[model samples]
Target: MASQNRVDLDGNPIKPITICMIGAGGFIGSHLCEKLMAETPHKVLALDVYNDKIKHLLEPDSLPWADRIQFHRLNIKNDSRLESLVRMADLTINLAAICTPADYNTRPLDTIYSNFIDAIPVVKYCSGNNKRLIHFSTCEVYGKTIGSFLPKDSPLRQDPAYYVLSEDASPCIFGPIEKQRWSYACAKQLIERLIYAEGAENGMDFTIVRPFNWIGPRMDFIPGIDGPSEGVPRVLACFSNNLLRHEPLKLVDGGQSQRTFIYIKDAIEAVLLMIENPARANGHIFNVGNPNNEVTVKQLAEMMTKVYAKVSGEPLLETPTIDISSEEFYGVGYDDSDKRIPDMTIINKQLGWNPKTSLWDLLESTLTYQHRTYAEAVKQATSKPAAS
Candidate 1:
């Protein structure tokens, strides 16, 4: 394999390359577009179906490096448009997909067709053009790890020597394929396979990153089924909002399920690192997250309550208790595994990258943001008096 660290002769660092990022409208991609434009030598063409959320970043004088980025309101499912965007750049990062569990559960067929089927053409295009492909995968593919600590064993041969885990350390899968929740995992796993095969068969330069539960600003924050999924709002945002508002921090099943989180910025850094080096990263996979950032639902509620009380001048919200009797909330084939954490030795050893932020830092920032937004929303809603 070529040296993972490919340096130019002068060693002064090459100018940032050009990049086209698909799905740039979503939470992660939007942040990544800005980060790349400001920090890397690469200029960016950000393409997504025009959405207000992403358009917020495109406002004049909003993004410090806005000139370095060209925004395209194109859909990834459109092959011709996608092809044009892919061919114009040196690297293409695809983040478009039904990312949340609830969203995927509600629209499995659509998710499969759009993200899986639609992405194949882009993969093929990148292969033909010899442009590097950076595709997003999820830790959900691991299913569930049975143990408290991650097992040390790993089957991934291309992983950096220092990053490999033992046999028992890889992620675990639960129940069976019949469960609807597994559809997300199934799709993600299939994409990983496809990327691996494309790299081996067609000489496509591909990098796969499976990120754990990463939460921060811009995360979907509403509660209920129509709310985000894989437990997005329920886990972080809900707890934060309730705590801030002095409402109950509802818990399902005593909040026992455990998960690890990495800040969005750290996740973005790992993706960029992979895109920069194809020789070492091509056909390789890495888990991007902070191992130190594990927290259970019960623990999260408590933490949010504590943080809110400490930060806000108002009295902390009363912690309302909820019964764990609902089987639908935490039944078999519904939510699997009690804990999930990544063994970071691989990415750290190979790319010299590791998640830098703590979960508290992410949570605090999220809480502050939510408080501000919610406060504004309340002001707007209450400003108008009720009609007789």
Candidate 2:
């Protein structure tokens, strides 16, 4: 309701712009779609292979902004309609990709194709059509931090210069070809290069977003419930499923790897700023994440255990998590970033944006959604299948 009086940073009334949102049914996309419909007058040409996540927004025509939103059910990989959709909109936001870590090593080919190859035509379409493009790259593109290579006891590791990922300054270091965990990161890096090349040679207007661990409700599916039984989503959903099923969270490599998480709602605000402030955003790569909410994977698991107990009235597990080697958990060729703390200089300077939610507060809200939405279903699923 407060969005009725929206204005740009320069005190200019924000004009509604149609966006061709590729992968508009994923975690980030669903939230963005919700924000746009509720808060802004913009139109979304929602594109994705699936629409289960955004189903509420697409149907019945009773909800507001129904006319302003359309679902294309388009796959950028082989879809013939990608170009036309990009050309029709004022901006094309490509969020389509295979981002989960499980598939990176097990399904490297699909990972590469989805993350990089599939994105080529989308980039080309936007460039050729002269449509402004906002490509959703990942913090995974940063791969690993410099401090990760140093001795564990090295005091130099404390220096922010060694670890803080900066959009303009940080080096993109990834594991070797064998450590196929880098497949997604490598693919994303290549695409980022290609996008930069497009901007340099073809003069494409673009903004690249590198999001740190943004987690909240409707993030990912719980395996054997809404998603495949063997599906492994990011850390949040992974731990949520374990908690809901009364099982221990699986920690890989002692869960020592550190990460920073921002509330998805907070992160979406940064994206909206990028969407409206093209003058400030274009030709820049923004790292949108909360450096203040840093924690180890083990710490995250422990925190979630307590949070779920509070939300669902369930008792916390005595041993909330079980540690396993990277080889056993992720299989061979899997590696992880030691840390991911975004240095917010670029995004702050460009969009005047900053993430606000604390980790514990974000997790509390997220677990409440998880318990309400999936706890009953998880109970039924884990029940012995009705004795056949």
Candidate 3:
């Protein structure tokens, strides 16, 4: 479609606007950059400390959208360039955060600082400059659902009213302060509150996105191959590393915590809708997720095992998963959300956005990519002689 013919949800023709996309080298950022370049006439000032994931889009100056995107390497923490970049663009999307679960408990201070303190300036710059802001927050901010506090056998535990997290209705619940796992969530919730206050008190145009486990290709790095050998990544990458090395998936505390996942592509579509249709999206905290794709971590592991086996052309292991206590895997002060099922009413009505992928189908595609990308690397790493 031509830029002239591009229309938003309300039939308003969308204008080409430059977007200052912080953390543009991350998984979601990379995908969003691709979408904008391939489909829209909008320009992106991509800012991130690293461009490894988005190198494909940056290099080969002869590419069609080469002129449409520019990568600037800078850390948002203390960089004076952040404010200027935010001023340069009509819209700012803040996707920078320390979101990995492993760091939440072990590196609580860094997690809090990265997620909350570092984001303070971004929010301020957008508000001060009167720029439209699309801030990415995690579904973790919702913390554990109310139903989780109910008795294990209680009938209310199965009720949607108890567990379904509504952006407008549900309360944000977190464990005691000592849990430390809630550090990231607590920081995010604070930042979100600050953003809301800015919107209300200062009349800043802002949209908050609480993503529910957006997963797909180019997500967190594979162990040893890309990231630190001992670093623990998100659940999908953790399981992918295990599958790649033909090792049993480790199930933290029997992996009973349930979560809903949306394909990164599907979620990005919703984001694009928010970007184009600001009238409907602004002043609204939207939950971007596929409620229909809910599954316990154990179920996710089983499904991933099957999908990896099929994709890799390898036989399924007799013992595909091993249960380990959270203390052993994540260290002390670890906690988890009992369930996360985003209420889709607001997003559906506001943006007409609904995630379209099924769990099995998404796992199939993701696992196929994982196998193709990391299987050989894992094989080579494992074949190397052990260090003395």
Which model scores highest in lDDT? 3
Q: List the candidates ranked by lDDT, beginning with the highest.
A: 3, 2, 1
Worst 10 residues of 1 by lDDT: 158-167
| Stretches of candidate 3 exceeding 4 Å from the true structure | 1-3
Candidate 1, 261-354: lDDT as tens digits: 7888888888767766665566778888887887887777777776666556557665454545324543443555556667776787667888
> What C-alpha lDDT do the candidate models reach, one value each?
0.69, 0.92, 0.94
* C-alpha lDDT of residue 260 in model 3: 91
Candidate 2 residue pairs in clash (backbone atoms < 3 Å): none
- How well is each residue in 12-110 modelled by candidate 2, as lDDT tens digits? 888888999999999999999999988899999999989999999988898778899999976677778888888899999999999989899999999
User: Which of the two candidates, 1 or 3, achieves a greater lDDT against the reference?
Assistant: 3
Best candidate, TM-score-wise?
3
- As for TM-score, the candidate ahead, 2 or 3, is 3
The runs of at least 3 residues in candidate 2 whose Cα sits more than 4 Å from the true structure, single-residue gaps closed, are: 1-5, 386-388
Candidate 1's error at 66, in angstroms? 3.4
Error of 3 at 179 (Å): 0.5
**Candidates, ranked, TM-score:** 3, 2, 1
Q: Which one wins by TM-score: 1 or 2?
A: 2
